[model samples]
Target: MGTKFRSSCPISSALDILGDKWTLLIIRDIMFGKKSTFKDFSSSGEKIASGILANRLAKLETLGILHKGKLPDNRKTVIYSLTQKGIELLPIIVDMILWSDNNLGDHVDEKMRELAKKIRLDKEAFVNNYTGHLKSLMAAL
Candidate 1:
């Protein structure tokens, strides 16, 4: 998985992998929405196209941010879970949620707005608790 970097800048380099519109959304779905299978993601409210979802899932796996697996009893079912590196993105995602809740106003969903309030109450605790939950989820996978 050789990715071409646009520049040596850290933000630019990170964007090379995550700057796309759909990549982080897919990550967001896996992290927050608890979406794992292709069908679950395809049925998301954003309605991402199948080709783009497949491409982004592959890219995330290549970048070491996601781990793809199969169900124990159902060989045909594909599942995706976040790696430790991907789990580290929780802070960034939480910050984005808070930022959107503050700036996006009504555009943000009610559930996210509620989450923003919880995040604001104690950001560190929220992140820590959620990170633990995600780690446990990964362990169960």
Candidate 2:
């Protein structure tokens, strides 16, 4: 699935799908390194509860940003992954991280700040090279 077209304006359309704080943060988590399970997301310090996490996961799937599935041998575990539409938001996520690091002042790590700067400088190239891993991550969902 993909973003549902609401109006011709891109901003309006994007907000219709990802306007909420949790949705974007969930996408950020998955794209950055929270791919495996719900526990990983909560552990990131956002402290999202199980119920809200489940709802956000469902909502993201409905918005086409996420796809969910269970591991074959571990039915008890569910994996959440970003779709192509979701991966396309990488630059936006990177920009947010960079902005937070710059403005939040000491909340984020210095090494991570450096990495985010590198990422922001070459967003397109970084995304292009990560396509294969992105696909594999999606497949895990």
Candidate 3:
């Protein structure tokens, strides 16, 4: 799980872990898509490869961004949940979504555009409410 940082800068170091194309998508799936299992992630719209998904999941777990666990009824089934550190990424994710909505208007779907508008109305409240919900969900797990 040890990663070698390319530079000492915080942004560079953070990017060293998260810069991969699929990592944040995985996080997005867990956070907003209500996806937890390996099967769920593999079947995402992005269609991430199984091997790559496994690698990214492991990396996230190692980085303390995700917690790996087993489903209560099915011990063999693996579930991935966001850690507190991962929950902290909400603002960044929201900003990314807003940026896409604003700068890539036509490309964004109507549903997301609407959500972005709601988010724009009060970005802090949106992030805070979602963060609280996620933390409660994690606690329930």
Q: Give me the candidate number with maximum TM-score.
A: 1
Once superposed on the true structure, which residue ranges of model 1 sit more than 4 Å away at CA?
A: none
lDDT of 1 by residue, 21-104 (tens): 898888899888989999999999999999999999998999899999998889899999999999999999999999999899
Order of all candidates by lDDT, from best down to worst? 1, 3, 2
Give one digit per residue, the lDDT tens place, for model 2 in 5-118: 789898998887788667787887776664557887877666777888888888888877777878779999888888888888877776777788879888887767887777
Whose TM-score is higher: candidate 1's or candidate 3's?
1
Q: Which structure among the candidates has the greatest lDDT?
A: 1
TM-score order of candidates, top first: 1, 3, 2
Candidate 3: Cα lDDT at 137 = 74
lDDT of the candidates, in the order given: 0.93, 0.77, 0.92
Q: Give per-residue CA lDDT, model 3, range 30-77, as digits (tens).
A: 888899999999999889999999999998999999999998889999
